[model samples]
Target: MSEHSYIAGIPLVLGGNVFGWTAKGDGAFAVLDAFYEAGGRMIDTADVYSAWVPGHEGGESEAVIGEWMESRSVRNDMRIHTKTGMLGGAELYEPARVLHSLDASLERLRSDTIDLYYAHKDYPELEIGQIVEAFDGAVQSGKVIALGASNFDAARLGAALDAANATGATPFTALQNEYNLVNREAYGPDLQALAQSRGIAMLPFFGLASGYLTGKYRTEEDFAKSMRGGRAQQLAGGKGPQVLEVMDAVATETGASLSAIALAWLVRQPGIPAPIASARTVDQLNELLEFTQVELSDDQLARLTAAA
Candidate 1:
């Protein structure tokens, strides 16, 4: 349906991977409050979030979001987008097993239904039709409004769409991939074509390149700032710096934060209704909120695109 994507009209979807890890309790609540008051309506989380952290098995972010929505009573006002198939691999994608995980995610999210549920990643070893049927099963139960594919390449996502059509199953309406300025390979020309043709909106993750595009990690010496600083260094070695250089010039001209400029650039791209990014603090969220105000001209977008 809706040409604006299922979430419809949200400028940004707040990333929730850091909710129970780097941000928690009052700190996490503050950021959530800021985002909501600033008109942010969607949050992207997964069953496997925070599992990489020591002592965290999984579902930490979901639980934290659940607590926030319950305590704040804003569940109806927000759109929740979460994923599955990341932790259990091929076996979890079995139709019955995938539905089981959907129940668990719904419980942890403290919701009767999820606005959007994604397959997390493509399991190519399994049949593409099987994967489509598995997620479509959730839609059949009315627990999920729409299905999405995360980390899926062009060929596989296209195949899954075709399978859904053949089987009369609900096709994926949203695509979440590792798309950003530096990492352009994840959502390249082929992927872009599919999203446009199928009317699937790409809610690109890592929109800030894990903080590299934020202009915080400009040099090797600045790599000690956070956990993703090493990734920043890797991004810095390639097109990261060049993109940041262009972003810096634009920021100077418009008095906007690099985070805002980066997200602003992403929103202007084709098939991207909104970009998914995270902020660890209220101050950080305010910086990200600046994206709503920063509008790039055609020439500026071209320069950032050329740099990337």
Candidate 2:
């Protein structure tokens, strides 16, 4: 793929899952502006974002992004990546549902075309050829510039690619999965190899392990710092602290923040063009932007990998 085909030059993709949820209204706007001003390009969101929240029917994040893009007049400069599927009562990957979901997402994003559209999860019950045909239909209609898959394993992704190739459909150009310094079981070597061989860009979410790698959740008291405290506590009980220690050393040596080191490690991995991260505040966004300035050494990378 060409550098401009996927999210190139930018080593980070700002996540929109926090928008209209933890970060509301002007807070979301400020964070978006800060990110763009810092040279960030892609913004990842979904149709079901914040739907679990009490009065939300989803599309909250996409609406915020749409408004921000219009008000800032940066719609042309931004690469909007949104997803379908995985919404409550609409998890199937059938053609009619896929097209309906894409139209709704387009309306919410205020864009005639989505730069990259993703299937949020794999529905094993659905036929791979049918799913490919549905997504390819969006591409042919100019509603989507590119296609992607998230939360899909190696076998399923391979099958989808095969189906697309055989049926003359547009194959998924990107893969988004849960991969971080501490959580590597889901996206292991096999998946990485398949994505690399197929030229699919890997943009892993939860790149900072839900803020655990930021070094703020060191102790029990630290867990109170955010709403993800319970998860942080659970991670701290495992190899989370060990990963933090190695990251600390790398940070001390490289003069980069823990978040930057964590993200830098991700961007350096095989087949990974960028990593997805979110900041509820402008300060946090600035910290994440620092990853571009950080370049880990071979020894440092090895030590960090071994530690993890």
Candidate 3:
């Protein structure tokens, strides 16, 4: 569709949430540099990113990316994607508020136009049309080139799309939901049906299951390896280990890292342009970039899917 041209045929979209949080200073720059050098263009981040960390009031990731782009002189060569409406209350979707949020994100990114912007999550208390109109206003003003819905349920996403069509406004061309080998609850049958019917490109987040699928968190002591280790504890106790076993076999057979296998699996799925992932180091980034080269066989893909 003409409306989806902006994000068509895209490669990996390097996530920036870890920039100001886990990957800082030159470490973050190294990862960004590795991604850019590898022909990666799109970078996904959020205004409220890293705010959960004490003393960080959001925009930290954007500032890191902005500084990197300026230092490397690659701002014009990249497609930047960021989100709004997560920090504020329900009224943040108001037209003026949406514009204000866009301006703030623009200032942080040191760019005039955001290639793609997202409503970080839906405010179900408000009307869908009102939210769509507010976001479309940003598009109308030439601020954001495209819009996407993140963390939206199937029913809500359908209504929002319908509302956009009803008003001839800018419809969401992409979706940012959590869909990985193990965590398929958010992008289940109903949401998949809507996405398939509407031809929405899925740019799924947490595609690595927050490092669980990397085969790094096997033992109980492995949980102490990183700041995000605690988050993967639940996955370790249940079906996560089972899924990791499959990924390990695939990795051994393919002579690739588990990280690469995980990402490659997502890239092979239908309707997914690319799965969003972050690398705290250039080594990890290189591993993920390998997904572009690796092609899972039909049996490998089936086993991976069934393991989940």
Candidate 4:
């Protein structure tokens, strides 16, 4: 069985990638305040978050989150999830490396224990037993409550589970895949089935397709709205416009914004506990938090599923 109960009611995981990158300091704090005020419980970040930015060496986002927690005095109220792979100059998925990376995460988050820790990317060549043992060591140290795997395929996830079972470590309780209206194939069939069979909670990243599903970017002009515009063009490719049309219809039918409806669909999926989405401002957060209260109907869901 899973070891974490971090996300139960909230329909979304407030993505922490924007902290210290797009929403630094007070701006990030405001977004966090908005999220908790609206009943959000889980905040997802990583040790390597925003490390791709110039002059950043990673852990910047986690530091901001720790500061927010200290400032707000609600550390116990929210579940903190952070990843350990692909940060700084570290290699991926080595057992000894996992120890060092998580220690760094602990210091940055200023927490004795993380509610959930994920291997940011799966390393296929590594022995599953070794990986599972590494995570179990964290749990043994009382530094992590549960461990998760992101960016892994069905076969690898199955192997990880077997290793965890053999080593008697905390099994993976959650999954973070690139799942959204535009990006479906990555986590479509095999991963979905495996997660369901193992009862692992699904937490999809790129939940809004990098803000494409928000209905704000429909043309070349809209691309200028974000520095991530070039990446957003993938959504504007084949059938992108058609998907937007369906989303628009659903928005009209449900009286929900396109972003909310999109997230509601993920929440309504079989294994998904919450969809991970980031907001750079309180205004954006308000729109995302609304998904906690919004429910999409069967027809609306069908429309989206088919269109997507």
- TM for every model, in the order presented, reads 0.97, 0.96, 0.96, 0.95
Model 3: ten consecutive residues of lowest lDDT: 1-10
> Model 4: residues >4 Å from true position, as ranges?
1-3, 88-92
| Runs in model 2 lying further than 4 Å from the true structure | 1-4, 89-91, 235-237
Q: What tens digits encode model 2's per-residue C-alpha lDDT throughout 1-308?
A: 24546474367899999998999989999999988888888999999998989999999999999989989999888889999887843345767777888899888888898999998988777777777888898898878899999998999999999999898899998999998888887689999899889998889998988889899888778888779887767655578878888998899899999999999999889888889999999999999999989989999999888886
Residue 285 in model 4: lDDT: 92
| Global lDDT scores for all candidate models | 0.89, 0.87, 0.87, 0.83
- Please report, as a residue range, the 10-residue window in candidate 1 with the lowest summed lDDT: 1-10
Best candidate (score: TM-score): 1
Clashes of 1: 0
Best by lDDT: 1
True lDDT of residue 11, candidate 2: 72
Q: How many backbone clashes does candidate 3 have?
A: 0
Off by over 4 Å in 3: 1-10, 235-237
Indicate the residue-level lDDT of 52 in model 4. Answer: 89
Among residues 3 or more apart in sequence or in different chains, the pairs in candidate 2 whose N, CA or C atoms overlap within 3 Å are none
Report the number of backbone clashes for model 2. 0
